[model samples]
Target: MRRFDSAQPILAGLVSAVVGYASSFTVVLAGLRAVGATPAQAASGLLALCAGIAATAVFLALRFRMPISIAWSTPGAALLVATGHVQGGWPAAVGAFLVCAALIVVAGLSPWLGRAIAAIPRPIAGAMLAGVILSLCTAPVRAVVDVPALAIPVVLAWAVLTRFARQWAVPGALLAAVVAIAVRGVHLTGVSIAPAAVLTVPTFNLPALISIAVPLFLVTMAAQNVPGMAVMATYGYTPPLRGVLVTTGLASAFAAPFGGHALNLAAITAALTAGPDTHPDPRRRWVATAALGAGQLTLGLGAGLAMALVLLSPPVLVIAVAGLALLSALGASLASAVTDPSGREAAVVTFVVTASGTTILNIGPAFWGLVAGGLTALLLYRRTRPSSPPDPTPPSPAATELPSPTAAGPAASR
Candidate 1:
């Protein structure tokens, strides 16, 4: 078992949990509603997602001795919001969730599929992610115009907190929202304190399977899981990818019956736990993720209350808070997509197509965005791709000893 010498990791974990749960929760609620979920079912979905992410984060961090942060797929939730009220409603959405989970499990089990996911062009992935969240990102301005009294205070709090305590910016904004709503007498008439889980039987529908499942799976993988892995690599922690994928996929499957959509490696919060700020020693950083898991579990117990708060507030106001929370992620994605000049045009095309909200063949813009961007990149950038230069430096001592992914177990697959 690992122990921490300082409490900084614990604090970081706490902040990560707060930000993770608070920032995108409205999006989750909106997604559930778009899929025709009742308020109770949406609350159940929140609980299930929090439970799944907590369990996976704790288990993987302990088992692998690595900082592994797990979270609900916000981009997948956004895709659900975009899909909006399929034929079979919430049950069909549940079925789509199950399908996505199964696909993730397959990807974990099959090295080729995992490699294929990894092979997706970074610019395309970033663009698709950017597109998914575009609507929510624009809500803040609309909210301010519609209800300046509520939106301005929350935005101001976010801006102020971002300057002083960057990690607490979203949480502070959320607190401001709560105060504003309450002060305005937004009564929580039917809100309940007791949390309860509700099980939903899945109803399979082909339209949802195509529009919701496929796109959700792709966005979750490309936007969240892939970036999460890259963040871990930046911290020099080479976790076993197969183990991670399998764990998260199983967690997602477990939560589906309770209405949770998708769970996977976390991109934003992973930085908090994996960085030197958590702990100077890389080996000890897993404790931060363990702490994060615990925090998530604690918060999960209050899903009913959280949902009630969201329900009591005006929809646009909740949306405005969500938009504020997602701004950082949106900026990061856009920056990543255009950072390379070679892929800039393709990335821009992908972003525009995705943001356009144009659906074709019952499929959402995300899928088409990827296809269009991929084709553009292939046509324009293929010739410009620099051929691998011959290595002038000798291989490191560890290079020959390191096994390929198949032999290395999980890490090789990643």
Candidate 2:
């Protein structure tokens, strides 16, 4: 069952995984571009994100009998944008990662963050999500302005097609946008082939750890991992958290040598892989996620090809596809934000601050945006926010929920 024999979830996993992977490419690329990552930095970040996602999906699938794709929180990416443009190069960035990773590992291993996740009111989570999605949707809006001559007709067509024909929304909207905006004569150029060699050496440069390690870790946890787990919880899987963190960490440790950075739980992406839309049997979804892993290996085994595609692919294609893919999520988030009368103001604050991309000091707007929203909800709208009221201090369970040194985890299970 652990090996290739587990093929039941293949059909659903395939479709969702394809869409998930494609949409993620847009996210990683857009974030990297915003941070002004060098070609190598961009490549490294992408590889880390992809490899981290694939490996996590496989682990969660096998562990929980469901499809799980651990994805980076694009919100986290928003947080790290400033770091990329900061004074330090890759070395400093590495330091930042170590810090971030340590924080996450502690959160996962300890009961604090875990309890927080469980305690957070469902409505608040929904509001936070709305804020996050609203922040990302603005990408397309700005992209449209940046390239209006081409963007105008494309976006107009997307609106018309999606408005008039609901079922034909995503693919149709994307098709119209990409085709209309793309310049002709653009095609894949030949790439150099490199021998497939497994790399295990991560040039441990301690000096730069402050910069690289912290930012990566921060974004990974707050943005990527938290949401990954949330998505799983939203779907009601509920796997072990510690194991998921450790495994993703291991994946990151291994892949770091190959230019991968922080890997963590995938929230938004897992929904794609684990939904009924992915497969009927929860036990079979692993196949679809496994397929995603294979794709990552392909990209790794063909690094030059990966880099070339990143370079050659039209920016318009990325924006158009990404915008359409995120459209549904954005709508869902926005709806959730305002659904509760009490949370309306807080949610609006989240949407505006986040969408503004304004930073507080060096911290990215996403983090501050969340902090701002949470505080406001607590202070101003305390009456409305569901009272988690200190866990009714019940007698402790006779035995902890652990196997005798065994039994184990997912952001996928969030």
Candidate 3:
């Protein structure tokens, strides 16, 4: 068993767990509600999703030589919300979960897919990532339209502070928004607040997989997995793609019955573990991912208490906190996307398309954003430099032989 000398993995894991869970949970709740989940059902379902990500984050991060954290697919939420509206019930969504899990596992195990992931140009991948985040960044703003007096100014204030102040922008903006909401006396009077109960047993049936399981699986993979690995690579942590996919698959496979539809590598949550804040030695920090699993277990056990807290907090708080928490990550990706002169235009196109929230055939924008960005990169940046590839050879546990992801490509498929 491999391990690191620094205590940073443990420290990073603790912080990453709390911040990532809280932020991602908000999205998960939105996802449940979008699917018309009862308030208690929504809380329990989000807890399950967190449980899945936390498990994968810990297992894969510990085994792989990178700070590999997992996260829920926020983009998938948009797709599922639409899916829930059309599909008739949660059974179809669960079916999507099962199918997506199978797909994720298959993709993880397949070397061709891993090769394909690695082959994508950095500029294109960066653009796709920006596209994903930009969409999420704008969600709070658009939510205001649903509750204009409430969601609008909160988003606008966040934008203004972010544009003007820069450093303290996200936190400050979130705080300001919270204060604004409070001043206006917007309370959750109609919202249900009773403690949520957990569904210990998973609901399963073959027919349900078709309507709910398959699409949810596709949405999770398209929206979450590909872009997440990109973020890991962007920051220079190159863990095995096979390991991650397998972990995500296992997580979802287990979580699906519990109504956790989407669980994969978390680009946003990963920033906490992948950045300079985690560890100077990339190899040392993978343990932190494992720690997240521990955190998930902790959260799962006390979900009733967690729901109590959520019921009390304002909706704007969730958006503002998530927006702020992701600001650093968002900036880093945007910087990566446009820094290369050749890839600049393609990246911009990717960002705009993703941010647009336009859907085709009910598929969300992340898929199209990646498609558009990849095509643009293909057309504009034809001269892609493929550095010396990793030796397509047998495994070695010794640290030196482990090729850096940036040095070679995304994780080598099994």
Among these predictions, the greatest lDDT belongs to 1
- Report the lDDT tens digits of candidate 2 across residue range 111-186: 8865755544333444444454454555567767676655566567667766895434454544555455345444
Clashing pairs in 1: 241-410, 405-412
Please report, in order, the local distance difference test score of every candidate based on alpha carbons. 0.84, 0.55, 0.61
User: Stretches of candidate 3 above 4 Å error?
Assistant: 1-7, 82-84, 112-153, 156-197, 200-219, 231-237, 296-414
> Distance from true position, residue 17, model 2, in Å?
2.7
Higher-lDDT candidate of 1 and 3: 1
Model 2 earns a TM-score of 0.67
Question: Residue 137 in candidate 3 has what lDDT?
Answer: 61
Give lDDT for model 3. 0.61
Off by over 4 Å in 1: 1-8, 375-414
**lDDT of each residue in 1-414, candidate 3, tens digit only:** 134446776777777677666545555665566555656777667768776766676667656667777777765654454333323355545555667787778878887865654565565566555655554565565566556665666566656866895534444544555566677765666665444445534344543443345435544554467667788888886777777788788787787666676777776667777777777777676777777778766766555544544455565455444555455556766787667655666678777776666666545555567677767655543333435775678657674443333332221110
Q: How many steric clashes does model 3 contain? A: 15
Q: Against the hidden true structure, what lDDT does model 1 obtain?
A: 0.84
Backbone atom clashes (below 3 Å) for every candidate: 2, 37, 15
